[model samples]
Target: MNSVRYTWPEGKKCAVVLSFDFDGITPYLWRSRHSQSKGISEKEQRRFGPRQGIYRILELLEKWEIKGSFYIPGVTAEEYPQAVEAIAKCGHEIGLHGYLHERVDELTRDKIEETLIKGKAAIEHIVGQRKMGYRSPSWEMTEDTFEVIKKYEVLYDSSLMGADHPYWINQMVELPVQWLLDDAIFYRYVGGGASVNPPANPATVIDTWKKEFEGIKKYGGLFMLTMHPWLSGRGSRILALESLISYLKMDSEIWWATAQEVAAYHQSLEVEGKNACLTEMIDR
Candidate 1:
């Protein structure tokens, strides 16, 4: 491996990719059972659901002057074009999340491709452009997911089933996989949150990210945060978000950009023939 690394964007120094998975943008669309069988309140689920999360995230991004990638379900985008429009206006990248919040592990390869194409179309119609990125619902990616993503020539995959660092899948080195973040798997599973009163150590979670960001900055790569619209939208989680951004903003070493911008920057560098990784890529 070459000791040299690719330089980040002109004004940007390190790469800090904060990707949000805005899954349930509407209360009605939430797949959580409507029945009170489980003793979960509809209001509680909806309040902590996708729409609220997205709104909170948008405000936070605006406050921090940061940009991020938002993966939207097709139905979510169709139902909430205003939200989509706001994201576009705010200059955040929008990518495919799925038409329904169905997990990909249960779906066939054909179904996956169909969903990808259809969802991409619907999202494009709502957001007014074809998104180059794709993230699976529930972090449920199958073996065939990568093949289909490559087939679509997707610029990247911020999907959670990946290694610590970013790397190419198939013939393209662009669409690197994204693993985990605080919103989706962390607050829900990583901690002993038997009740909301005493959740995971917030500082530890923040430090985990701080360490991840430091490594990415040190090695010149990979700080993909998988924030969900529903989870990170409220309470202590939002404060955690604030802390993370405040820390990052203190040092302007990273490029706080949308996913598309990051992909485009890497693509441009690949075109420039300055990085050995690109030079060795014969397909380029």
Candidate 2:
């Protein structure tokens, strides 16, 4: 818990960031690097994201007039340029997710840096600008990942789970996330995989998210939701997201923002000397 409460813009009690990892066929290819050309079934399943899932998710965001942060792999962006371009056209923030949804921890430092550069270039090619944020493919980052991202001058990262609120890491802001708030844990299932967990009830998952939001509001912290278009864009599951959004909007005290917006706001607070106590928490 924060010893001192931090203030939010417009007198809002808490901040919320709705983030989506637009992983198309990259995850499947990453899992089976040798089967890229032969993994027809797996590839097609994952392709649902670019083919239909992203459109559905985009429609929901548009209907609610909300701008989300989308983390796209270089492969996904390259393979689905039209989908990526549409996301940009909708005024959503694009962030780097990796070159092929590769886990950074498993890569060497040089590989990590290379992937970051490639991923940024791919997104830039589609969005016409460099992304200001990053989220690791599997919430796994190497010790050198931060340094690599810093070299790129990325403004923030959403992969770490160090805290409930945004904090500085080296030269970048870290908007932390937890598995409990991620939609994948509740819905993702792989056939014939070791330790397969069945999907949880959508209503129960939404209730849990609402409870998390209420607690953040009580403490004036940030609520960051990590979602995957492939997992949560289904008709039945999307209803939970819609309900959660509607419920949150019923209260005017929540500051709904994209990850970049929250990062910029935190930076502004530091510049104004209003974030001294918050920075102290990070130091501790």
> Against the hidden reference, what TM-scores do the models get?
0.78, 0.95
Off by over 4 Å in 2: 34-39
Question: Superposing every Cα of model 1 onto the true structure, what RMSD results?
Answer: 4.4
1-284: candidate 1 lDDT, tens digit per residue: 65545477675546777887776633234444354444344334544544567778888898878888888788777767778888888988888787776678877999888888887887888666664777777666666887888888787766553334344445444434444354544665322243454445666778888887887677676577777666677677888889998998898677776777766766666567555563454335
Stretches of candidate 1 above 4 Å error? 1-6, 11-13, 25-47, 140-143, 150-153, 160-166, 174-180, 189-198, 277-284
lDDT of each: 0.68, 0.87
What is the Å distance of residue 135 in model 2 from its true position? Answer: 0.8
Clashes of each: 2, 0
Write the residue-wise lDDT of candidate 2 on 96-127 in tens digits.
Answer: 99999999988998999999989989988878
Which candidate ranks first by TM-score, i.e. highest? 2
- Candidate 1, TM-score vs. the true structure? 0.78
